[model samples]
Target: MTIAFISDIHGNFEALKAVLAEIDRMRVAEIVCVGDVVGYYSQVNECCDELRRRGIPSVLGNHDWYLGYGGFCTRSRSVNECLVYQRKVITSENVNWLRAFHLQMQMDTVRIVHAGWSDPIDEYLTNPSEDYFARLSGTHFVSGHTHVQSIHRFGGKTYCNPGSVGQPRDGDPRAAFATFDGETFALHRVAYDMQKVFDRMEAAGFHDYYYGGLKTGAKNLRRLAD
Candidate 1:
């Protein structure tokens, strides 16, 4: 089965729409989102609703937890401010849906998480050693959080990050995602109408940092390189 993996959408409906369009074109059998579906952007509800409508299986993200449990104040001040603004706009139903998501999921030979399987929502496997990857139980472990696209092979397992779909930090502005067909994995970078997402953020009165991140995927790449 061909599985399409995406993550770190951060509520950019335009980017998500573009990615979905591409996924539809590819005709993948399954689409899974790694998480962070409701942070840093203005269209949380729209994004969540579309994911629900499509019946995509998604893992919960840290941002989703912070938004649902009113834990924003304890997180990063900037992220707190963004969540506060997001809370004002997101619907109660969407919040509940985010709350219901699991931090990790396993299907056949594949394992999915917003971060690493070891810590799920909190730990990043960006620089995991061979021992670390070997410890993971799945043949294919997929995660996204550092927002850098990479495929790492260790021992007998494959670890992958599809990067960020809406707010890529990988220095490349193009939207990043990946596809796995059991034996092979392919990374993709697709261009979207960033100006449209920027305009929506402005119209919604979201903070500039959110929109600024979309202009370039530099932040994500920097984090990965670190």
Candidate 2:
């Protein structure tokens, strides 16, 4: 059985659709989300509805928590703007779904979480310390928070981050995901209607920087990730 992993789908329905199609083409048996099903874009409900409809299990993300309760982290002005708009437009049912996400899930020897295991909601474990790596018990540790696709191996543990499905920060702007079949791990990316997403974001009162950054695969976010 192959398990497909997706994460950081920040409400871009177009990208989600494309990624789902790609997953379908791969004939994956199980699908799981690492979270951030909302924030920084339009179609928050649409994305949430799709995931809920498909019965995909997802872990909690920081943005999902913010949407469920209130307030933003020390983020950008535009990010806060988008969150405010999302709060205004999101449905109660979708909010409930986002709020009900599990912090971490374990399947066999594989462990999945939105971010790191220590501080699941807020931490970014791109460059984990030796002590942290020593604590990692699973053969495979899957997470997504940096919006950058990566696979790291250290201390007999393999960490796989499938990147951002909605807002990829890598040099490639396609929707990023990965699949693992207990042996081989495969990473895949699919193209979506980014212009349509940009237009919708603009219609919803977002500025061009969102589109520009997404278009260029978030060169600005590289600094933050590094």
Candidate 3:
């Protein structure tokens, strides 16, 4: 079976739409999103509705927790502000759906989540250690936080981060995801009409930095190199 893993959508329908288009062309049999379905950008409802319509099994990310429960997280002020805004605008049904997301799911050999295994919902792993990877019990443990695409191997198992769909920070400046056939997994970064994304952000009154990051994928370029 070929499974597609996508995460950290953050309400950028353009990016999500672009990635899904590519996935449709691939050999994907099952698709799952490790969350953050509503944060940073403004089309929270559109993003959530699409996922709900598609029936993708998604785990809750830190931003999703904030939106679902009116709680605080370690995210930046701008991100928290975006979540605060989404809290007012998201439909009640969608909010309930977000609340129903699990922190982790296991499907045969695949272990899935939105963050690290330790804390699950809030931990961010930029370069997770092999020991940490070993602790996860699966042939493939998949997660998406830190907005970077990578895979760490320990023994015969693989730890994969599909990167961020809405807010990729790996310096490639494109929407990111991963696909797994029965044998191996590969990462993909797809380009979209980012100007349209910028226009939407502007219309929504999001800060300029949000659009700037999408334009350059310049966030933490140094950390990505390390």
Candidate 4:
């Protein structure tokens, strides 16, 4: 059975739709989300509704926690600003759904978390060492944060990050995801209509500062010149 993994949607419905279409075409048997269902984009409600409609199981991401529970992000002021805007537009039902997400999940042998195992909601697994993977108790682990797609193998164990569907930061301006076929994790990228996202963000009153890096897949969020 092939299981598709998606993460960090961040309210980009166009990207999410494109990814889902690809997953459907690939005939994946199951789909799971690593979270960040709402953030950094304008279609927060649409993204949430799609995921919930598909009954995708997802872990709690830091952004989701913030919007769902009224928390704040200290790492990025832009993130907090986006959260503030999202809160006003997101439905109460969607907020309730986001609040119900778990910190971690165990799907047979595959352990899933939104960020890292130690701090599921906020750790960016950018450069984990062999020791870090060794301490983990599972052969297959999945996480999504950092918006970078990656796979690390250590001591016969494997870790995979499906990357970000909404805001990719891996130097590849494409929607990113992964698939597990009970053995290896395969990374995939699909191009989507980014202009639609831009238009919607503009209509929603967000400036280019919120989405400029999406075209180049820059590691950091775009900011205005100093």
Candidate 5:
């Protein structure tokens, strides 16, 4: 089965639309989202509605937790501030969906999580070694959170990250995603209309930095993909 994986959408409807179009062109059997469906952008409700409409399975992201559960303080002070601002504008339905999301999912050959399987929703395994993969007990482990797209082979297992679809932090402005065709994995980056998103953010009256981040894909005053 060909499964297309995308993550860290962060509520950019334009980016998600472009990615879905590309996925249709690829004729993927299924589309799986690695989460962070809300946070950082202005179209949280639309993004969540679209994901639900498409019947995509998703794991919970840190941003989703903060927005839904009101516990961003436990994650990071800066993230807390961002979530606090987002909460004021987010709709009630989207918040409810995020609150009920799962942290991890296990499929036949693929294990999906917003972060590492060991730590689930919170910990990030950016450079998990051979020992880490050996302990996981899955042929393929897919995760996203760091917003850097990479594929790692350790022991007998393969680890794949699709990066961020809307808020890509890998130094590339193009939206990043990945596809797994049972045996092989391929990363894809697609260009979208950034100005359109920027205009929306402006009209919504979001923080200036929020819209600027979309243009550069940088966060926390750091360049993309620190």
Candidate 6:
């Protein structure tokens, strides 16, 4: 069975729609989300509702935790600003759905989490070493927190990050996702109408400071001087 893995879909419906459309074309058998269904953008409800409608299972992400459980993102005020806006517009039912997400999930040989196993909803699993993968309990592991798409192999174990569906930061502005065909994994990128997202953000009273990095997929969120 072929499975599609998506993560960090921080409410960019345009990106999500494009990714899902591509996944549809591939006729993928199953789709799983690593999480962050809400945060950093508008249209949180659309993203959540689409996932719920498709019955896609997701692990809990830090952003989802912040909004669902009520907490501030101490690391990035921009994240908190987006969360504040999202909270006002998201449906209570979707909030409940976000609350129901698990920190990690295991499906046969595949292990999935929104971030590192040690800190499932918050850790950034970048630059993982062989020793790191050795401690993991599965043949195939998947997580997404850094918004960078990559695949690593250590011994017989494999680790994959599907990247960000909404806020990709790997120097590629396109939407990012991945697919696994049991034996191997593949990362994929597709372009979406980012202008539409920008327009929506502006309509919602946000400035370019909120979405300037999307065009180039900068490593950090863009500031006015950037």
Indicate whether candidate 1 or candidate 5 has the larger lDDT: 1
* 10 residues in a row with least lDDT, candidate 6: 217-226
Ranking by lDDT: 6, 4, 2, 3, 1, 5
Model 1 misplacement above 4 A:
73-75, 220-226
Runs of candidate 6 with Cα error greater than 4 angstroms are 223-226
Candidate 2 per-residue C-alpha lDDT over 106-187 given as tens digits, one digit per residue, 9 for 90 to 100: 8666799888888888788767566776776767888898888988777677778998998888789999999888865678
Worst 10 residues of 1 by lDDT: 217-226
lDDT by residue for model 4 (1-226), tens: 7899999999999999999999999999699999898888999999999999999989999889989999987767888888888988999999999999999988767999998988998887899778998887879999998899999888789999999898888899899999999999999999999999999989988899889899998887685110
The numbered model that scores best in lDDT is 6
Clashes of 3: 0
lDDT string, candidate 6, 31-130, tens digits: 9999999888899999999999999999999889998999878877777888889989988999999999999998668999998989998888889888
**In model 2, where do residues sit more than 4 Å from their true spots?**
129-131, 221-226
How much does candidate 3 score in TM-score?
A: 0.93
Model 6 residue 106 distance off true place after TM-score fit, in angstroms:
1.0
Task: Output the worst ten-in-a-row residue range by lDDT, candidate 5.
Answer: 217-226
Q: Give the whole-model CA lDDT for all candidates, comma-separated.
A: 0.82, 0.84, 0.82, 0.90, 0.81, 0.91
* Model 2: worst 10 consecutive residues (lDDT sum): 217-226
Candidate 5 has an lDDT of 0.81
Q: What's the CA RMSD for each of the models?
A: 2.5, 2.0, 2.8, 2.0, 2.3, 1.9
Superposed Cα deviation of residue 103, candidate 4 (Å): 0.3
Better of 2 and 4 by lDDT: 4
Clash-forming residue pairs, model 2: none
For the record, the alpha-carbon RMSD of candidate 5 to the native fold, in angstroms, is 2.3
Per-model TM-score on C-alpha atoms? 0.93, 0.94, 0.93, 0.97, 0.91, 0.97
